[model samples]
Target: MAASGKKNNILKVLLIIVLIIGLVAAWLGYQAFMSPSIATSEDYFYVHTDEPYESVIKRIEDEGIVKNPTYFKYVAKSMDLQNGIKPGRYKLSKDLSNRRFIGNLRGGYQEAVPFRFQNLRLKENFAGALGKSFEADSTTFLNILNNETIAEKYGFNKDNFFSMFIPNTYEIYWNTKPEEIIDRFASEYKKFWNADRKAKAAALDMTPEQVSVLASIVKGEALHVDEMPEIAGLYINRLKRGMLLQADPTVIFANNDFTIRRVLNRHLTIDNPYNTYRYKGLPPGPIMMPSIASIDAVLNYNHHDYIYMCAKDDFSGYHNFAKTVAEHQINARKFQQALDARNIKK
Candidate 1:
């Protein structure tokens, strides 16, 4: 009777063990099969690219976009998604398992934002605006552009720093870095400067830097692109004739204050190297970043002996080109009359 009882007890123990194993297996199978796939629009979550990875995971978990961060991290590591997950705004959901979430990220499943550059003045301004749009540090981006080491590595002189960047609308990922933005612009600039453009610049006895400087002047002077070539011609004539460019924009740049309503006689007398009236040649560097149209205009300037130009009194979007001081003075008087009539003293 004792042997039979012991056998029954061993059988019961074995049966309990089998039941426990079966329960565990069933639970694991349920977990594996019940894990959600990529979330659709109904379960979307937004993530800013600037957020750190850990912070992003926390937010995802808190927002119910992910069941657990540990599982996500484990799956991400196993799938080698550490580098594959692009940095940007993403849409995700808690129902999605780690695998699906990573796949969505890798597949660039996010909304795109538009970036436009219309009438930006300084390179810093453009960089700041772009950085804010992308959730990046604008100052950091400007530093990269102004970095001496990087500039030298990229064969950029101080004069050529912002030469290649052309303002236009761009479609970019919200998480793009400032450095990447600059790199893309620089690459685009290089592509625009083809062999024909290089030969044209060289034939005019001008380096790319000098052409860009002239282009900057053109940008500062003319509001209309149609007048750019003629405006460029006027400055080239002044340079060839050993006359001061005498551009008011250079005076404004030298003063470091663009708010002065009028270019006072004293302003011209201010002995800054950038003052074209004082300095016989182009300024040490570009006064501002120039557009591609301006640069192209300078490269293909009108071949005229015009040494001076003054804005038309009618605000006709054209200038009165002159080869003599008297002619320029007359045009200047007409412009002054127009300014006086409109009570605009600048």
Candidate 2:
């Protein structure tokens, strides 16, 4: 009876040992199959400009950069990277563990390049510069601004193509679509337009577009912010009296070249609708992109009876105002004398 009891005890101990070994083997197998491998593989991965999150996962899977697309999607969701993935060209490899890769993507590993719009004149050049910075299609982007249908929808005429846009520095994700970027800028512009500006535009008997046109001229003419209000008033007075604006900027625009070192009789005769000297009322559109200061100047213009202005030779950025041609000619001669003395011709 003692021997049989001992045999039963040994059999139980052996069974328990086998069961423990089996459990451990199963656990090891599960871990090996579920975990990402750290073995390096030759694969290229790309994240297109403005590509959605789901598309990014598919690209990762398709390029063999990740072992499983569904698993990556799950990880990305848990990390809250669904809508936060930046657009750019990314090079990835399978050597990275799943956790490390997810962390990298969520951390925003791509670089941001800034596109600045300062002292720029042409709309096409602006589009091209932005496109090049973002690796987008420059031609396609510029074409949108040039398109008659699109321009009309945006409340733009041929003359106002460049004027409608405000200049500022923008940080755009690489590969963003050109149209998407334009829409983004339009949305940003709304912050500059408040109720007060809208009411002021209404008081001037002008649309926001027309106000922008005047503001652009103000931007090009004024040498300082302090000069804008009075310059704006001078133009408004001329408009009210049915007198020619006779702005030198208009003549420069009509000439289709900005290097107007001197304005002459020939420049006045080169003639397009933009020449306020030849045609009455405001030019067809603005001559340059206006700053907020210039826009505000036109909106809340000072109520003055002055109709003419000439730049002061003192370089104080202030203009001499006159109400008659004779007074204006005297101021003009003063400016001319100063210019001639400085070897500047007009």
Candidate 3:
């Protein structure tokens, strides 16, 4: 009886030990999988193209995104996240668990970054801005824009391809392919030119690209929103009469010198198609990205016989419109006098 009793006690002790061990293991598993791992400092974690999984782990550690790297690594390994890593911008929430973070990465739940640009003067400027906003470099986008084949594929050439990008805020993924971005812009362009807009363009005897070119010119000339329609009307009148646009903004663009406050006779003689004073009608392409307001103004232009506009002498960013050369010369002289008075010699 004594031997049997001792054996029973020994069994009870062993049972207690096993229970303690199981509880400890459960606690450790909870700590690794259920504990909050993410920190609130970073809003996003970026994984670059072809980046090593080990590098991602190190980045998480180095960026202080996770409180415990070991726990994250263990969870990631268990879920096979390394094999399913995707390159993108992932959103990081405060107090996220290791399992949830790893699952998000594995599932490729990326955040869409807002890409916004406007009033850019050149394609190079746009490319540089776009490069800073996304993973694709400036050279990649610029090359695609400059490629004759790609431009032609989109019904444009290198010279006029800049007009295809309608300036606005758009949501896109960080790791979006350069070609995919162009396709998105093309889709947006089609949506913008609906049947009503197309009919208006046809009535004005201009294509969508031509309207954009004029809209850019109008945007460059007009500072006030209300004046845009009048400016558009004036340009349309010039185009209809077969007269040179003789726009000073085009002169500034052709000279590649935006610092010229005043356009002179010397600047007008530039040997470039963009020089509207020397060439006829619109430029080969838009000098700047046209705004939606400017574009709509062109589509709804105010009809008038006034063909000339000179900046008002008051420097209120308003222009004096005239119907004839004699009246336009008077307005120009007043503006010149005002510039001289202000010592704005270019």
Candidate 4:
């Protein structure tokens, strides 16, 4: 009976040891799987294309995404995250755990980047903006834009291809390829020029691209949205009369000097197709990306007889429209006097 009691006491000690081990194991499991892992300053974490797992781990540490990476690394290895690291922009909340973070990476769950672009003047500007927002560099985007074959595939030439990208906030993956981005723009361009818009373009005896070209000039000329329709009307009148557009914006574009606040006579004499003063009709392509409002203004231009325009002397960013060259000259003289008064001699 004493021997039996000793065995019972030994069993109790062993059971206590087992219970302690179980508790420690549970605590470790909870730490490894459920503890808050991410403590990032940035709301999103970017894993670049072809970036190695080691680089990503280092970035997480360097970027202060976590206080301790050891447990995260352990979870990642258990989940096989290193072998299957998906390139993407991932949203990291403060509540994300090691297991949850590794699970997202392993499952290829990534957030889409909301990319917004506007007021871009040149293809270089567009490429630079895209490069900053995506994994593809500026050179990659520029090369695709300059490729004549790709341009033709999208039903545009190199000159007019700039008009294809409509300015708006778009959702795209950070790892999206340049070709894929171009394809998305093509899809958006088609969607923007619907039946109603196409009919409006047709009524004006212009293609959608041509309308965008005129819209770009109007966008450059008018800062006020209300003035766009009237400015578009003035240019349309000049087009109807077979008169040279003589738009100062075109001369500025041809010179490639955005700093030119005042267009000089020499600027008009620039031997370039983009110089509307030298060439009749619209320029070969859009000088800049036209806003949607600017494009719509062209399609819904005011019906008027005004064929000329000069910036108002008040410097209020409005233009004075005229039916005759004499009236336009008067407006121009007043604006010139105002510019002289301000010492704007450029």
10 residues in a row with least lDDT, candidate 1: 37-46
| lDDT, residue 315, model 3 | 95
lDDT of 3 by residue, 55-85 (tens): 9989888888888788888888999997998
Model 2 has an lDDT value of: 0.75
Instruction: Give each model's whole-structure lDDT.
Output: 0.76, 0.75, 0.91, 0.91
Instruction: Give, for candidate 3, the lowest lDDT window spanning 10 residues.
Output: 35-44
lDDT of 4: 0.91
Model 2 weakest 10-residue run by lDDT: 37-46
Off by over 4 Å in 1: 1-54, 57-86, 91-102, 106-115, 169-177
lDDT of 1 by residue, 166-242 (tens): 66777777777666777777777777788888898998788887888888989989989998999998898888888
- For candidate 2, what is the TM-score? 0.70
Measure candidate 4: CA RMSD: 1.4
Query: Which RMSD values do the candidates have, in order?
Result: 6.8, 7.8, 2.0, 1.4
Higher-TM-score candidate of 3 and 4: 4
lDDT of 1 at 35: 76
Sort by TM-score, best first. 4, 3, 1, 2
Number of the top TM-score candidate: 4
